[model samples]
Structures are given as C-alpha cells and as structure tokens.
Target chain A: MLRGICLEVPPGALVRIEGGNGGGKSTLLRLVAGIDAPTEGRVGGRPPRTAYVPERFPVALPLTALSYLTHLGRVHGLGRAEAARRAAHWLDRFGAAGHARTPMAELSKGTSQKVAVVQALLAGPDLLVLDEAWTGLDARARSELDLAVAERTAAGAAVVFVDHDPARLAGVSDAHYRVEGTGLAPVAPVAPVVPAVAPGSRVRIRAAAAPGSVLPPGLSGRPGPDGAVVLTVDAARSDEVLRTLLGARPPWHVRTVEELP
Target chain B: MTALLRYQGALLLRSQRWLAPFVAYAAFVAVGIRPGDPVLDSLGYAAAGLVPLAAWLVRICVTNEPGAARDCAAAAAGPVRVHAAALLTGLAGALLTGALAAAAALLVCDRAATGPGAAAVAGALVTVVCALTGSAVGALSGRPLVRRRGYGILAAALGSLLALVLAPSPARGAVSALVSGARSGTAEVPLTALAVALALAAATGTAACLAAARRG
Candidate 1:
C-alpha cells in the first residue's frame, strides 16, 4: 500500500524510478500508467495514448507476435492498416521481424520481451511506462531500445521506467525518485560521468577488399590511401564490424585498427 | 470501447476457453430436451442452463489473460474499459450460445401445443434475460471480488444458482413465465424481467469495472 505519494511527469521528460525489490516500484509505475487506480490518492494528467511493458512478459498467448501487436495497435486507436504497418515496422526495428508469424507460445524469453516492447511502441504512445522492460533483451536489442526511448522522449512523450541496471539511461533522465517504505521521495539526479575520452569512443579500421567484390550489406566505409577502406565505428561495435568484414566471401584483409582519440 | 471489445473477443475466441461452457450448455440441452418435449418446456430448460454457463463464460473471459498481458491492455485502455470489455465479451458469447441452443430446441421440440411463433418469442426473451442476469453474477464473482480461483468458482456457482432459483431474480421470473406460458397455451413476454436484468447487469458491470482499477 502506497500513501502520500505525489509525482508528476511532464511530456518529453524521462523519469527514473529506483527502489529495492518489492519496494512498490512496480506499484508506483502501475499507478502512473493507469493500470491500477490509487486507493487514497489521485493520478491525474495521464495522456490518452498510454503504453506499458511489464518486467516479466512470460505470456504464452495463443496469438502470434504480429497478430498480438496488431491488436494492441488497434487498441491504442490506430486504424487497421496503420496498426499492421506499425506492428511490422517495430518488430523489424527490434530485429524480431523473422519471428513475426511465430506463435507467442513458442517464442523464447528474449523474443517475447521484444514483442512486449514492440507492442508498447507500435502506437507511438504519449506516455510509456516500463517496468524492468529491458531485462531479457540482447545487447543489440538493448541498445536499440535505448535509442527508441531517446526517440520517444525527443518526440515529446513522457517515459517512466524502473530498471535494475544502474547505467540504464543514466544521467539522461530528467527526473528521479526513490520509492521508500510507503511513499515516494525525490532523489537528486546522477551527475553525468565523462571519461578521458568521451563515453562513445570510436575505432578506425583499415581493410583491403578484393577488387570488384561488393561491400557487405549495411557496411559503409570511405576509400583510404592505397586502396584500403577506412571505416569508423563505435568502439563497442568494432568487433562485430570486423567479424562482418572477415565473415564475407573472399574476406577482406585487415590492415590496422586505430583508436580514435 | 469497440477496440477493447474486439481485443477481448479475440482473446476469448482464440484461446478456445469458450468450448468448455459451450459444450456444457450443449450437453445440458441434449440430455434434458428429448425429441418430443414441449417447445416452451424445452426452451425453459435450455434457458435455465444458460445462467450458469453465462456466469462461467464471464469468469473465463475476465481471467483469460495472464496478469502481465492484462496490465499491458489496461495501460493502453483504462482498466475500467478493459474489465468491461471482458465482461461484455463473455455476455456476447453466452447470448450467441443461447440463441443457437434456442434454435436447436425449436427445431426438435413439439411446438403444436404452443404456437411456434409464441414459443420462439418467449424462448428468445428468456434467453436474453437469463444471459443478462448470469453475466451480472459473473461480474460480481470475478477477479477483483474473489481473487482466489477456488473461492471465485464457488461464488460464481452459488451466485448462478441463486440467480436461477431466487423468487425475485429476473432470470427466475422470466424462466417461470415461459414455463407457465407453456402450460396455459399463451405467450408471455418478460419485458419487465428484461428491464430488471438489463439494469442489474449495467450496475454490476459498472461496479466490477470501477473496482478493477481501484482494487488491482
């Protein structure tokens, strides 16, 4: 039971909720999402289009991912065609497009979580509430979801989330609160941390490809001196970029890997 | 509301949970109404069976979704609309099943004694009234009120029984009107009972929907 809990989330703001396990974090998020009515207090100013993603989406529903997302899109007030389009778009964006027709009951945990996230984004809701929504996602999908959250906030939507990862969207949240025993308390925002090199450091890779061999799909690089191609990518993704180049037919020869200062 | 209804209807249809109550209703009709039973009598028996079936369907619809999915839907639509959609879908399913059962009774029962037209009208009215009353029973006995599965089922069964046997229950009154009409060779429309059932259903639905958000 929560009492004397007063919180306000404005449009375009990202609010982070922090609390210990079973400390009413989920309950607070539920009230904010209008999933549950407050017993003694009131939650006002909720937008009409709201979406929520639960912490554990362990549903083995009868519908397929695409069908379930389409239904949710319509529930969020989109037309039939628009709902289907958005459902497919979001599914593809999250790298779950291949599983669109797969029955929900047969989906793996991470894929089901992807579908849950896709359903929330399909309608472009004005308010998005996420309770441990990123738990089971892969690193790629986790980053994709981070980007999606950024896009939603940029589009003037309010986002409230509770995640166990301390670095999840750290320093970017506009507001922060901690759920205490029976009420909410405002917590100071975490200071943005700056490394010697900016957090998203880049790597420059020089590779020589066979003549007349087309570059791998989705790989873009500039021609370097002496016929070598120069590719710049985030340090975190340099491995994947290298793997893609080497994994191609008649693999490209790596010349050098230099850290971008 | 339309979208919510559609979503809930899809859940009920695709889940195939409707089959249990449906088959039960069908079994009740097949076993009770023989080839030569009186038209009104068969219909009364068929309609009586629907009360419990309707309540069962409502419980199924309300609880069909896993808790997380229900929360997702509740966030998209309000909790009240979602709850109301579940209740309405169950009622709609019950009404559809009742119609089919009534039709089957009309086809097989001895309708010469009570005119087919009178039997048809009375049967349809009682079917509607009983379904409505049964839905009300379901709304009250479902999730928010009775959280435990064992107790919720007990409450629904007991509630349906009371709805059918109570002296002032609209379902009871309507079914009795059909039975008395069968004996007197006259058609009596249970308009008053219908109104009462409609009101009861609306009140129960509103209460359950409101409580869903408050009590969740």
Candidate 2:
C-alpha cells in the first residue's frame, strides 16, 4: 500500500525525487507510468504523454536500436521513414552507432540503458519519468544525459527523475523533493542567484501577500535612517515571499535579500 | 488486431535467436533418418522434429516484460484472444516451414517408399500436432507459478510417455500392412492413434491460446 504521499510539480519543472531504498520511489514512478495500480488513494492527472524509463530498462526483442525506436515512433504516430531517421540520429547522439545493428540482448547493460533513454526522449513526452536512470554510467555518459535532459526541458518539457546521488544532479535540477511516509515535500529550489539590488533596499513579505497588498513587518512605506525601508526578511521565507512582494503592483524597486550588503 | 499480429510476427521472425535452435534440430532430424517401414519412419521423423520446436516456442511466448504486459492491457488491445491468436499464428508459420522441409526431404529420399503424397500428409499432420502442443505448453510456461525448466521437463516426459505407448509395433507384418494400406487386420490402430494425437494437439493448443489470452 502507498503510504502518505503527495506531490505537485509545475509544468516544465526539473524536479528530482529522492527517497531511501524500498521507500516506494520506483513504485511511484511505475504508477505514474501506468504500469502499476495504486492500492488505495487516487492519483489524479490527465493520462500523461510520457516517456518512462524504468529501473530495469526494458528492451523490445529482435529489433535493432534503429528498428525498435522506429517502431516506438510509429506507435506514437510518426511516419515509418521519419521514425527510422530520428532513431538513427538518437543512436549516433548516444555514441551507440557502432552497436546500432546489435540486438538488445547483445548490448551491455549501460548501452541498453542509453537506448532506453533515447527511446523515451525521442518520443518528446510532455512528462519524462526516469527511475534511477542515473545509475551505471561514467562521468561522460552522465554529462551527456544531463545535456539531453536540458535540451528537452529547454523545449518546455517537464522532467521527473529519481536519483540516489543528489550531487550528480546538482546543476540540472530546478527543484528537489524527498518522498517520506506520506507524500512529496519540497526540499528546496536549487538555482544560482545574481544580486539585482543592494541589501538595504530588500524587503520582507508574509504569506497571503497579494497584489497591491502592503508589505508586512512594518517595512511598508516607512523610510529608515538610511533613507529607504532597507527591507530585511527572515531567511526561511525570503525566496518565495520576497519574490511575491517584489512582483506586486507598484513593483518594489528594492534589491532581493541576498543583494543586501 | 492485424497490426498486433504483424508486429508480433515480425519480431518473432527477425529475432532469429529464438528460432535458430529449432531450425538446427529440425535439420538434425532430416539428416539422421535411415531406411525403415514407410509409415513408421515418417512418424518417427515427425515426432523427433516436434520436440525441440515445442520447447523453443514455449520459451518465447512466456518470457515477456511484466511492465509491457501491463501497458498492452491498459491500451485497450481487447482481451487475451488477440494476443493468443498472434502467438499461435507465429507458431503455425514456424511449424509450416519445418513441415515443408521434412516433406521435401521425404519426397527426395523416397526412403519410406510411401510416395510424396502420403509422406507430405503425415508430415503436415505431425507438424500441426507438435505446433499446437508447443503453443499450449508455452502458454503454461507464462504462468508465474510454474518454473519454466521444470515445466519443460514435465512436458518432455509426458510427450515421451505418450509416444512410447502409442508408437506402432516394430513387427514387420503389422508395419508392412499399415504402410501398404491393406485394411485387412490392424488398420484401426494407426488411424486411431493419429486421431487421438490430433485431438490432443488441438485441445491443448486451444486451451493454451485461451489461457495466454486471459492472463496476458
């Protein structure tokens, strides 16, 4: 049975799912992939246009990378020749051209995993579900995978990947979550920030802060000894709360909290 | 359904990995034959060729990804009937190929002195029986509860027992009379045995196909 689990991912978000082994991480992905049924609670969403790479990559029999991917393309409604060409392109991209004609059984586990990855990517799924997809790869392969994911997300695709090593995905993810006993809880957003304004100009904002609403914590409209309110925010709520305050009507001409010197 | 059949058939044929052993064994049977009673020789060739073919087909039909099975079911591909039909079609094609080769060999060798017509008919019958039995056995292999190696051994044992009990006697008079189409004494034995084999094959094939369709 799936225990308390909840998650909400915005479109085009690069979300990382993390959990201990046997924590239903892969099971969650399978349920999302429509490969398994949940015992009790409902999983709500439109049937996703998705590319799911399972923990154990499943390769179809008797078909070469080209042929198998081409078949998958056809299954997704691409023309046969078009599918073949795209498949060939992906194989070459993955450095799998030398073994393009090899049957899946003959390929090493890593090679097969690459084929599985490419197959999913070629589908251009709206939601990409990758379960432990980062396992078994050299640094170079991992970099290639990161690049592929970046390209897909740049084109506005939502990607959800399960990974045991968070550092491997450091630069790639926009958001991270830990799957606990119940559901997913936001761990943090991971993005490098550039200071846009000085610290004294930064401001604090509170929850339920709406457009045109005055900034809370006595920082609205009051000038300090230095001249501006020099908004100071509690660090915990600074990211989301400050962004909301700055984006409100009248548009605060203040620097973000991090910009404060 | 047509699309599924084409997809399945193409995969099975192209894999070559699965079909290679069966082909090799069939070749071995063709090469191993020596002169004997025409009917008995044909029967022996048919039985020998069928054993490996059944084993291979069973393995192919059962070893599929559980995830893929779930996906296929979710996609509204109808029930197991369509899948079973496709698998059976594949097995039938393989059987036909083997039967044709065996019949051609019999015709060329004329070792049985039974003429091409009788040899061809017997080969076809034997091929059908074997194919059906293989398909049935393969369907059973797909069950999670059954161990494939154990199932294979059991099927082989059962088949050998049936062959031993039903095999024609080696007596020259009986064998010659059966081959010569002389209906005086013991015509009923061979005919009854063939009928029972055919019936068993048909029943098992149908059952296997049905079971596969439902489970798949």
DockQ of each: 0.66, 0.13
**What is the C-alpha local distance difference test score of each model?**
0.91, 0.57
Q: Where in model 1 is the C-alpha error above 4 Å?
A: A194-261
Candidate 1 chain A: minimum summed lDDT over ten consecutive residues — where? A190-199
lDDT of 2 by residue, B1-216 (tens): 444455555566676555675667667766765444344354445545554465456555444333442243222233344345445654665576667656655655444345456555555555555555444444444443244667755664565344334444112222233444422211223444445545655565566545443333
* DockQ of candidate 1 against the true complex: 0.66
B-chain TM-scores per prediction: 0.97, 0.65
Task: Give model 2's clash tally.
Answer: 9
TM-score of chain B of 1: 0.97
What pairs collide in candidate 1?
none
lDDT of 1 by residue, B114-197 (tens): 888878999999999999999999998899878899998999999999998999999999999889888887879999999999
Number of clashing pairs per prediction, in order? 0, 9
What would the C-alpha RMSD of candidate 2 be, to one decimal place?
Answer: 12.2
